[model samples]
Target: TWSTDGVINEYCEPCEAIVEGELVEVPPLEEREEFSLDGVTYEAFNTSGGLGTLAETLKGKVRTLNYRTIRYPGHAAIMKALLNDLGLRHRRDVLKDIFESALPATLQ
Candidate 1:
């Protein structure tokens, strides 16, 4: 039962090593602009908060790095539409409230 399979061992290494290793700062998200048929302009930005931070920390240590958000498939579309409708594109507090109201809290 003590077979040291390299594949399994490498895959099962301590998550703490990646989670607690290095701390890095995340740069601003990359953005681009697009216009709808009605001439409504909108800005699209990447979801890079913790992901960017982790990528910076693991830049050289890991071969590849990426970040993913856990949300409903249409979350972005819903958010964009809400922001456009409310004219609160850059309002962080309002955005936070809108999102928080929609998503349940994992921890108190």
Candidate 2:
């Protein structure tokens, strides 16, 4: 679900196990890659999203799978700075305020 404050809260059925982690610097190859889909160019980078859960469920079933998040160029770096360098991850309220104020919602 999404909040008016520009925060997206997600919920899912409890997994048998949950993966906990911290953000880490992505390798160059995984940091930025360009791809074309449906005549539109996009940038992608490795992110610690739901891959851990998927990996746990697919253990031994698939040889390998790579997961990435598509985002605007430089978006990862900015997020890293906000959530890691600036230590906003520990203060979600501040982060939400920043998002709500600095970034106006857009249909596009």
Cα lDDT tens digits, model 1, 3-68, are: 223212221222221323443322222223343545644543334333435555675587544333
Q: Which predicted model would earn the best TM-score?
A: 2
Off by over 4 Å in 2: 1-31, 37-41, 48-53, 106-108
Model 1 reaches what TM-score against the true structure?
0.38
Which stretch of 10 consecutive residues in model 2 shows the poorest summed lDDT? 8-17
- Residues 1-108 of candidate 2: C-alpha lDDT, one tens digit per residue: 335332321111111222233222233214468888898787875544335666666555665544566766676677768766888767777877887888767674
Tell me which residue pairs clash in candidate 1.
none
Supply the global lDDT for candidate 2. Answer: 0.53
TM-score of each: 0.38, 0.55
